[model samples]
Structure formats: C-alpha cells, structure tokens
Target: MAGRSIEPFREIGGRLALVRKAYGLTQRQLAERVGRPASYIAKLELAERRLDVIDLEELARALDLDPGLLLSRLMGKDPI
Candidate 1:
C-alpha cells in the first residue's frame, strides 16, 4: 500500500491468482502457507479485497517467488 501508487486491485488479484495456480496450490493450501483463511485468499483472488506488501510477501514465500517480482507483476511491470 506504500511506496508505489495504488494500482487497481482487480488486476493485482488476477496476477495473484495466476501465480498461485502456477504453483499448483489450492486456495486452502496457499492460505495454510500464509497463515490466512481460505476465504481470505478467495476474496483476494476475486478482487473483493486488497493486498498490502506484507500479504504479498507471505504469498511469495509460499509460492517460492520474490516479493518484488510479485509486486512488479501486480503493477503491470513484469510478468509472473
């Protein structure tokens, strides 16, 4: 939420979904890794919610991705 201008969360959500699925993780599975509820991941993926850097870090850790790269992807800079 800081450092960069707020990007459209709908786009971010779609990227997040792509990365999560690429890792072959279910919403529940990714949530377990991030210590969140499946519904939380579901909401984020559906663009019903927003993501902060901390949340992105947790997901990157779970998916073996770099947080910056993930953020870049969300910002429409680089691909995941």
Candidate 2:
C-alpha cells in the first residue's frame, strides 16, 4: 500500500465539516472542546490527517453525539 492515497476516507472529512457547521461550532471552538489545536481540526476536516479511535471518541463527545452514529455517518452509512 505504499504511496496509496487516503482518498477513500475523504468523504468522512466532508461529513465532519457538515456536522460541525450544523452545530454552529467553528473549527477552533471544536478543537478547544477536544483539547486539540485549531490546525488539527482543520487538517481532519481537510482529510490531511487521519482520525484514530480515541480521537473519534473525543470528537463525538465534544459534538454531543454517539461515537457509533458519528462513525456511521463518516462511513457514509445510515445510522441504525
């Protein structure tokens, strides 16, 4: 998988951006809630960074959402 791009996960970033906008939270605000820098949030939203399980949980909590539901949305699936 050398040089393989992360394009497949790009939609997750798009979904994250939409959710963040829907909640009326700026990237900096969300980063503050997650104890990360604004640039980190920007990177995630741009798919320039990959999200790990721990970060996903933290982001879900900060967004007042269930982690599973958030993951489902990120994966482009309807939440069950």
lDDT of each: 0.79, 0.81
Please provide, for model 2 over 18-80, each residue's C-alpha lDDT reduced to its tens digit, 9 standing for 90 to 100: 789999999999999999899998998888888778888899999998776656754668653
Model 2 lDDT at residue 51: 78
Candidate 2 TM-score to native = 0.82
- Any idea how many clashes model 1 has? 0
Candidate 1 structure quality by residue, lDDT tens digits, 1-80? 46844446766777788888888889999999988899999998886777877888888888887776656854658854
Q: Which residue pairs clash within candidate 1?
A: none
- How do the predictions measure up, each by TM-score? 0.79, 0.82
What lDDT is reached at residue 8 by model 2? 46
Looking at model 2, residue 78 earns an lDDT score of 67
Task: Score residue 60 of candidate 1 by CA lDDT.
Answer: 84
Best-fitting candidate, measured by TM-score?
2
